[model samples]
Target: MNRRRRQWALKKNLLRAAVLSFAVSCASNAAFADDEHRGRDDDHSGRHPKVEHVLLVSFDGLHEQDVARCIASNACPNIALLAKAGTTYTNAHTPGLSDSFPGLAALVTGGTPKTAGLFYDVSYDRTLYAPSDTSCTGLQGWNVVFDETTGIDAMNGGALTHLDGGGGFNPQAIPHAKIDGVCKPVYPHDYLKTNTVFEVIKQKLPGARTAWADKHAWGYDWLNGPSGRGVDDLMRTEINSTDPATGTDYTDVYSHTEKFDDLHVQAIINQIDGKDSKGDATVGVPTLLGTNFQTLSVAQKAPVAKGGGYLDASFTPGPQVSAAIGYLDTSLGRMVAELKQRGLYRSTAIIVTSKHGQSPADHTKLVKNGDTLSKLLESNNYFDASGNFGQANTKSGSLNDGTGLTGTGFIQTDDVGLVWLRDQKQLAAAVKTLKDNLSCNAPGICADGPGAYILYGAPLRARFGNPAEGRTPDIIVQPNPGVIYTTSTKKDAEHGGNAPDDNHLGLVVFVPGAPGAGERVRDRVETTQVAPTILQMLGLAPKLLKAVVSEGTQPLPGCEERRF
Candidate 1:
């Protein structure tokens, strides 16, 4: 055949494939919906077929590209195994800000920062009073710093000595909010504006046991939702706490982070064995249980010289990262093996995704601004005379001491700059200052530089939310892809940004004995959908989740369609 004829034939074949795929997807969805209706009619119960347990796992900093590369190279055997039996959403992404708070909130709450009221882990809340001022008196814009330091140690000068997050959040570190004219301290759970999947599951399935494990004992408390009792067993393994063996934090080394993650892994195994997270109590296996692995996140942040981070923009893993992925795969295999041993494999649904992906996967584009954005804002009179730029109440008696809220102006920067101006009237001035100084020659943020741009005024509000509401940042500066606004030389990349490398996530929904093995869904989906999907799997109403109702979240496409 001639060249043009051959090209025409190829195009025709491609169109045929596309049409076939669409038809199959529609048929699958229709079949599952029919099955669901029948199940409800026959059983008189809301539960879906096949799945009795939902195991949600988050591999922080695991990008879609990482999963694709790993699976292609057979580096991540366990994930590959899940993908082979499940549908992998290759174009999945986080809903809003890539910060851990908002990212994780999106997954569990089925909402974005706009509805969840979560922007970053340590963010500014203009409606909240300082932690020290519980009476709802003077100076409202409180820098809400809910991290590892928010634990009980803060009451005694801040010491992260224990693994259980110093026995949970310190009352002293909690900000106060006036509700119904009564001033009350707001715990991490109260910070959320919407309910979580855990809360919905608990409400719908009264006997269902919910649990979760994460890095922070205090900051992650928000996962419990507004009720604070959503999760029946919330693990308190603090990753930032000092490890006696290494004399440093678990995040200081990739291998050390593996050791830290292993604790959660063991907790999961214990849960599978019909025990609590500690393996000491027989609390029964939780219906919804999972943990976030930080080893990959640590490896991505570590310097290249330390055998961490990616080798190039293609996301080929370096030594530390490769090992971290291997470890995660092995850990996942262990969970699958446990499920099989317990004869729960066919009845369980597994979800593998990430809170956020590390930015500047291409190391050659790294730009360390050394906190220059804060300095510029401070020098330009964006902050008070005391250099307090919305950040205050230093329980540790130092500025930006990394323990308590101790900065000026609510400025949090990683790969992007989230600025909540102390004075909203100065939004224009701040934007101009950033625009005027868009030069790489200066040791500050470059607005017009490569992959750099400013978001403020109506555009910023339209995308994020109305900044006037207090939680949203007045101005946002997404700098160059690799331009991290930090001075720390310990890491090469960071997350918490809108960059491609930061938001693009890996998402896989695996159910044993489910049809459509090795199917890949190229359709774009949000991580927020995971919440409602989980409810659907458990035969609960997704609308039971407040965010699902408000945000109009839908179940993942292949999830309900491919009935096990």
Candidate 2:
């Protein structure tokens, strides 16, 4: 695509933050709070004269249902107490497909995936335009993975220095090869064509001390990091060299959950102490924090690591839910108590939220290659595991309309499959046959699940359609829910869909005396609005927190927009 088209696409996805009036009902149990009219907190900071400090925490995948259910069960009291103190939006949400990339983009950029150019783990960059089969190879720059799946990665880069290899790239030691992918994402913060909230903050409050921490790569999105889009401190290091002081020991020893829990708790404690061994809160400086948290990252056919399981929607319960609720609660309680002890609880504002939610692991509901669909296709000869689809009985016939296509292969599994054909012309024929034979079966294959609509032709083109692109796969097949491309049996739950439970996630704001916080607010809320809201609390101008492109409208007053 050309620059003109890309610009148009970008405009279409810009996120706008506005007070929305919506129905009072939601899947979450908490009721919506009435919007309060505007009021004033004219008090100035010691010097800044407006907003003094800000903290944002981005947990992995917590849904609105999870919040309500956990709250009722007392699985999370720290967050629950905040709900009672602040305005908790039952309707708070991420973009429809709450995948990580888009979810985090919404969190920091206030832009949708389409607008932010974010897709799944490996997405086709339309602007750069690479084919799907080159194994997505050939890059002008390194593909940066901004993740913090392991505590070691959090403290040091992906180096396992805490154990061996000096905390550098040591995928071999990882329990699973997939864990290597847990490395941080390559954020285009430096390449960002637009400004972010942090840029605005520095422009306004130059003296403020800002910080951030997370298991993910974009921890300090405030400054966006070394690349300099916007961000200050990120807990990571280079590809080689590692020592314990660099933070290699933490992730190397503990799980993502435990490591994050420990890090944040300790950070809170440091702030409370108010001394840097020099014994001076005013003399030197101490206790500055940024958003932080942890969770399982890699996804297999099944869940492993702990807190890994299939998400059965808001109504469905899973053992992992209880474990997650318990761990997160303990962590939050530690944070709050630390604040009170430090005497900063009354003046501090805590914003708690997650990047996305999870989908329960349920294979029975999935429709992949090993299922009845593939069997019927194979028997009918419409599908061939050996890629001999139109010429098995007789090799004389042309495979790609007489193109004499030579290279082809096929990978199959119960959930999804990968078919690489040599002839582009054969794509249409194969698709038609599959729909007529496989989808027409008792269970329709095309719906909202994995196999819903095929992301083929021009949609899959360029990245999939480019004639010269080496990465272009002959074919990319999508499976319905439960159906995955991987043969791993451990993956019972997943995401990457347009499901409500998947789209809606967990969110909490903890502070004393926040109105309607204990319950839910039915009014429509969004992640992009988070930055703006936080800036508002600090008494900063909307633009500083919202960023130049932010679409958030100012809240009415004490009460936000009214919900159900």
**How does model 1 score by TM-score?**
0.88
RMSD of each: 10.0, 12.9
Which tens-of-lDDT digit does each residue in 1-564 have in candidate 2? 689998977765552222322211111212111211111322223221222344566666676776787778877776776676655667777754455655766665555543344444332221231111123233321112223322233332233333222333222111111113332322334323345555556556656444444443332232362236354434332222233455543333224345445655565455445432212343212223454454322221225344344444333344554565567677777766665555455456666777776543332454333344444445445445444522121233411111111233222332333343434466777667556643434433333443345445676543324422422333444445554433344555456554444566677664333334355567677676665555555545555433324444443233233332
lDDT of 1 by residue, 1-564 (tens): 699999999999887765433111211111123333443222233332356788999999999999999999999888887887678899999975798988999899889888898988878877887667667875677788788867776455556788887785776668888999999999899999999999888888868899899998887888889998999999988898888887888988888899999998999999999999999999888899999999999999999877879898899999988999999999999997787677666567889999999988888988786777777887888865455453344546643233344224578888888998868888889888888877655745755655578888888776678988888898888887788888788999999988889999999887644467678889999999898888877767678888888778887877643321
TM-score of each: 0.88, 0.60
| Candidate 2 local distance difference test against the native | 0.44
